[model samples]
Target: MSFFDRFKNPKTAEEKKRIRQERLLLILSGVLLGISFPPFPFPFSLLAFVAFIPFLLVIERRETLLTLNKATYLMSFVFSLITLYWVGSWQPESDPFLMAGGIALLLAYPCVMLIASTLYYLSGKIFPKKINLWFFPVYWVLTEYLLTLTDIHFPWILLGHGQVKFLAFIQAADIIGTFGLSLVVFYINVFLYKAFSNYKNNNRYSVNYLVAGVSIFLLFVVYGLIRISSIELPNRKVRVGLIQPDINPWKKWGTGSLDKMVDDYLSLSQQAVDSGAQIIFWPETALPVYLMGGNYQNEVDKIYSFLEKNKVTLLSGMPDIQYYFNKEDAPADAKFNKSTNSYYTAYNALIELTPGTRNYKRYGKMKLVPLGEHVPFSEEFSFLADIFKWGVGLGGWNIGKDTLVFKVPVENNLGKDTISVSGLICFESVFPIFVAAFVQRGAEFIAVVTNDSWYGNSSGPYQHKDFAILRAVENRRSVVRAANGGISCIINPLGEIEAETKMFTKDVLVGDVVLNKEKTFYTEHPKIVTAIISIFSLWVVGINILLFIKKKFDL
Candidate 1:
């Protein structure tokens, strides 16, 4: 039977009514989830609590595995579509119909959701009735952790991210990471669903589960309050200048005047320096050309000269190319050019140019944006690139291997010391584990340089900025975000937005970011939570397989 046959071939009026009700509930869940995100409709993040309740109700009502799977997919797809419509809007000129990008977005969010939902349903089938709810939350978190392991990672819409504005509630991320918060959210929805169902059936409500759920939530809030009150900004401070050039990325890509763009950035850097800025940060692709690719040495030297004359360190995003005589020596993902007769690797990198130093420290971006910066599975099927290519000259960038940290000299009232900095380019800021690894490697603070102009004036920029807050709270590190368009801001360790710029505006933001060497529980033991969950997931699978064997063989 075709996929749509179920809708058309309803045998009874009750079945038709049930299908209509399920569709409505699923869509409601999606909208509620979307509005719960940052830059919310009215800043009511508590909507997230009840957002999944409708979907849970639909799942409970499912009579078959197929129905449960369909309901889950519908809920997830609608939620992803509503909240992440900007995914399709990115680089529309390159993908006029938004097919390639749209399909990629579908795979990133909805398809992942389908997998999570399927796992959830399967886990429920394997577990006993009373303990099934617990399994779903754990399995959901496992699914989220699994996303981090893949190349096409989109950790943007994690449940903890929705609560970033509630600084007093989400500080627990420092201990257990964002997955812990997601676990809490799922438990709450399950509790509410149980309560509502019991009331409908005139049965005694599960007060024990309710108390346990409420206690967990209260603990998160109380722990957050204590942690927030105890956080101390380090004495050593770095006055960082964030430049939002407000250049339209599409237009910037097409423009020929590379010198003009470089001058624009330098002029802004000078403005920041005039205001006592010690370190200047420019957005991703601010130079638009490979600085070390040997073609733009003069322009690269011009920026270097400005940094030298002002005695300020500049951290800017630029394309970097490394040529290899042997293709075997290049990275596994490196692209080979037949015309050049050499294999080379390209990176979306953050370069640190300091005064009186010819050798600059370069940190290549590890998490390349799928379909936008790097095409997935291109190595296996190179023709997939021509089919999925969009945006002028965007795609097929090689991934970076190292978690490079740069040291910057700064002074405080106490004394002077070099601060270790972790520079995250573009979407790398969204990954909790990725940022924590840098902190574990002794990065005092985090700097995020991005080109969000591709998202235009949509909620994409706002949503992107919110992730920085979670990263700050999770790692207890100050985040300095410099976006090409707007939403540039400085986020303190407590998940507070100290300063920010409006979207689509040319602006310079200068703020003091405290340099701290303290590592939080999350940074020191990054994958502890996920690791524990993985072991339990394996145990669950093992038990299920053993039970199936026993039942099949009458053992």
Candidate 2:
């Protein structure tokens, strides 16, 4: 039968009614999931608690595995389309064919959600009796955790991220990370589903399920309240300056005057320094040109001299190049220029220019945006680069191997103290564990440099900033974000925005940021929760495999 024929006419009247009900339920779940994210009118975060219940009900009632898979994929695809449609707004003028942007907005997240849903369904089937309701949360958490380990890592619509605006309930992230929040939300959905299912069949609800769900949710709220109240700002404060240049990403490389851009940055830096800013920050690729390249020596000298004269350290994002003697000696994924016959690696780096020193410390960006910065698995499948090269004009970049931290001298009331700053370049701020790793390695404050101009005035920048707040709460470190075209702000350890800038504005924000060194439970043991879930998931998969073999062979 054709694809539509199966859904167009059912075998019986009862089957037709069942299919209609299933469609409504799946659509309801998808809409609920979508509105839970930012840019939606209301922050109805409560919807997240029961968003997946409809899908769960659909899965449980499915007569065939193929039907279940198709239903799950449709639900997930709808959810992805609603929440991540802003991705399609990225450089549409450049991508007339919409191939690259389409993959990002339409294809990527749906595929991820489909994989997650499949695992969840499989886990349910494997432990039908013992783990009917419990497996969903575990499988979902495992799926999110594994996404972090991949090259095309996009954890934007993680269930926990939906609760960012509801700060009071998400403080548990400081201890357990966002995966824990996902577990909490999914468990509540499972409990509610069970309670309602029991009520439908027996005309009575399961008191245990209701109690468990309510109690766990209340526990998170209580913990959040206590945690927010307990946090005290550190005594040592660093006066940091953030510059938002509002450069148009499309014309930034070719059309705009390079000299004029540098002058604008210098003017802003001077304004920030005059306001008694101890350390100044610039957005990602603020310099526009490769600072390390020979062409920009005069511009580099100007910046260095300004830093030396003001006695203030300047941390700016710029493009960097590292040339290799031999193509084989370069990183496995390093791009080669056929024209230059040179092997080189390009980086979106944070350069720290200290007073009285030409020698600058650099932190190369590690977690790159999949197609924007580097195509995934381009090294293994070289043709993928040509296929996915539409949006940014730049090809795949070499991944940075080290987690480097810079020590900036901050003069506080007590004496001169040093604040260890960790750099998160552009999309790197979205990863929870990646930021936590820097904190564990002696980073006192996190600095994010990004250029969100490509997103325009869409929900993309807002969502990006929301992820940074979670990172701050997770690691209990203050975040200083510098975005090229807006939303630059300083977020406190309690997930509060201390200072901010509007989108598409050239502005300078100077704020007193508390330099904190104390690490949270999450920082000390970042992957402990994920490790436990992964181990259990593997065991469940093993059991499922054995059960399948036994049933197939008639054992």
Candidate 3:
């Protein structure tokens, strides 16, 4: 029968009722997961623990993988729409290409989710035992981790991100990372589903499942409390200033705005320096033009003059260009400049300038925002670049090859030393593994520079700010975030926000952030944790496939 024919008419009243209940359960699961995210109040995140139970119950009654996947896809779509609706920047000035990308993500993310459900369904069919449900966490977490490894990656809805408001509960991120938290949440939901199923069947053992689920939760909370209490932040500190210029992101790229933009940054840096700030941070793309690309020498001199006058180090996110004079030095994909007869590329990058240091340190942003910053598989299908260009000219940034740490000299009443810091530009902050890589490389603190103004007064900025909290906890390093329109703040090693600015406001946040040279267990051994999880996921799926082959082929 055709896929649509199955839904045309139910043969009996009981079947119709079951179908209606399944649809409601799927929607319920989606709504629970959606409202649990940021921009909602605290305690809402608790809903995430039980969110998957309803969906699992629906999966239990479905016999065919096709029907089960279809149900899972709709549930995922509802969740994605709620969490990622602001990605397209649906304003009057928004680029059509940007909007198109956003819509595509909402549609495609659900299809990606089908991988986990299919695994679960097949495992259950092969195992023919209730024990198969216990592997759901592994299947789900593997999918979340796999999403982080690709160019079209968007790990925005990782289950652990929902617990950002519950600080004490998330302290364990230092040891396990966000993906581990996802595993824990998924297990709890599976147990709860088991308890509910057993209770409906009048089994007294339902209490055991309930107790098992609650016990894991309580154990995690106890561990979190102990961890949060035992955390002793480093004594060394640096007073950093975050400049939120509140510039209209769309208008800044137009003609005659470069001078004013630089002036605004200098003016804000002066305020921070006057307040005794040793380091000043500017938001992403602070200078829309290439300030160091030979043509903007005058602007470069102005920035240098201000840094020298204040004796303060300035780290800002901006567009960086590199021209390869030698043909052999250029990558095959490098754009050719006909006027100069040279090959070059542009990057969304962070540059650090210190007083008396003519050579600035720079780190190009590695994780590009899918279609907004780059086209996925552009290298394999080169024509994609021609069709996916954004009107604002930010659609084609070359990926950065290296992760760099900035070394800044600091001096105060007690002593002087060079602090090692790593900068994450824009969406690079979302990947847990990516953030921890910098910590493993000896970064004492983390700096994030972003332009959240494009989305404007939405949950995107708020959610972006909160994700930094997990990074702080995971790496046990302070996170200092500077955004164009606000939510600029400092997050300590314990995932606490020290100071923050309001959205769409032009302001400066000056706060003392700790400099910690220590790395967390998660930072040191992320591979081990993810490897074990991946092994279990693959082991179960591999067994299921082998079993099916043996049964069908009589091998």
Candidate 4:
């Protein structure tokens, strides 16, 4: 029979009530889970684990033959709808319907979430009830592990992402990255689920759940204490300055506000210099015009000259546009490799200025944002350039090739150190691996330049800045973040905000913090920690397979 036919015309109202309960359980779980997204902040984060107990209990302990497939999909649907709401928030003006299509994708991806739930449920079904409790957490952790593939896999709302605000809880991030908290969150939920399911009937399960939960909580406490005590942060401070220009991008780029924008930055930088800053940083795309071009060569030289005379290292986020040709004047749509085969402008960027340096050195930003930096299918399906607004003259951005390092000789009251600095522009700071790459490549300090003006007064800037602080803590490196509309701050290697400027304010903060030459685990081997977790995940999968074989053969 068909799906609905199986449950249709139930002889008793009891059957209808059971179906209704299943639907409610799934939808509620999905919606509550979305709160686990960023902005809620942790140890308020532990609330998300509570959401899972009800949902998982309902899915695993169902008595009827009404398969969980439908409920799981609905749960996934509700989740993606709320969690990935930002995707639909940004729509191209040309096609308003594109927003709706983007929103639809959020629900469509619920299939994968449903599949994840299905695997976990299958493990519980095959194993003994007592053993299943342990496997439930393991299975869920494995599900989260596999959710890190490119394009398709979505790892956005992993439980730890919610802990962005809590420094102490997130200290674990330095050791195991965000995935560890995901496993812990689900492990707690699994124990709770069994506790609730076995309540009244056994009552014993609840005690076990409490014991396990308390144990995990204590372990995290011990972990935090150990990390804070054992890991002595090397004396790595920098005399840093952050300038917030408070310029509107639309008016600056599209209107006649160019002069005003330039004046805002120059004034901010001078103010920072007056405050005795040894290094000054400006926000992303700070320069309205190309400084290095032959036409503007004199201006670029002038900025360098001023910086040198001031004895300060000036880090500015400016776009360095370069024309690229396959041979000579190859058509704009010329192909390179299969991935990036479009002929257009490429970026020669991330320039650093030190007072008295002969010339400025630059590093182009790698790992560009999907639509904002370069259109995905523009190379394979090249028509996206002209037809759809992905052209150099308009919407498209040129990709940068190299990672820029800014070498500076920093001096303190006690002594001086030769420090190598690098920058992560805008969304580049959001990617842990990318920032870790810079640290591995001999960068002693991180300078994150972001323009959150487009994001407006939402929690966007705070959320973005919060993640940047994690990079600092994870690498034990000082981070200086310069933004267009404030939330500009200095983050120490321990993930503490040593100093911060107010949001949406025209402010310049200058302070003396050390920049060190010491090494950090996250800086040394980025993928190493994530790789160890990945291996543990594979072991969980292997155990599940072994158990399945034992069940099938009755061995």
**Most accurate candidate by lDDT:** 3
Q: Write the per-residue lDDT of candidate 1 for residues 1-555, one digit (tens) a residue.
A: 777876687889997898798899999998898888877843577888778889888876665667777887788777777678887775545456355576657655766666556665557667765566556777777777777766667787888788877888889888887888888888787887777776777767666656766777788889889988887777778899999999877777776699888888899889999988989999998877787776888887898899888888988898888898797797776677889888888888998888888888888889988877777777777788777765567676777889989888755445666879999998898888888989988998999999877766787888889878989988889999999997899999898899999988889999888778888888888788788889987877777788889989999
C-alpha local distance difference test of each model: 0.81, 0.82, 0.88, 0.66
Which lDDT tens digits does candidate 3 get at residues 344-421?
A: 988898999888868987788889988899988897888998888888999889888899999888774357878888
Show where candidate 3 strays beyond 4 Å.
1-7, 544-554
Clash pairs for candidate 1: none
lDDT score, residue 384, model 4?
67
Candidate 4 has its poorest 10 consecutive residues by lDDT at 89-98
- Of 1 and 3, the candidate ahead on TM-score is 3
TM-score between model 1 and native: 0.94
lDDT of 2 by residue, 1-555 (tens): 786776675678997798899999999998998888876533588799999989988887764557766787788778888877767565545554344555555765666655555666566776663365577678777777777777778777888888888888899998889988888898899888887777777745577778878888899999999989988878878888999989887777776777788789989999998988999999998866777764788787788878888899989898888877697798776777888888787887888888877777888888887777777888788898888765445545667779988998867666788889998898888788888989988998999999877767888898888778889899888999999998999999899988899999999999888778898898898888888988987887788899899999999
Identify the runs in model 1 with alpha carbons over 4 angstroms from their true place: 1-8, 41-43, 90-94, 97-99, 326-332, 380-383, 412-415, 547-555
lDDT of 4 by residue, 220-305 (tens): 76876677677666555667778888876545554554445655666777788788777788888786566664366556666676
Q: How much RMSD separates candidate 1 from the native structure? A: 2.5
All candidates: TM-score? 0.94, 0.94, 0.97, 0.81
Stretch of 10 with least lDDT, candidate 3: 410-419
Candidate 1 CA-lDDT value: 0.81
Scanning candidate 1 in windows of ten residues, the lowest lDDT window is 91-100
- Give the local distance difference test score of model 2: 0.82
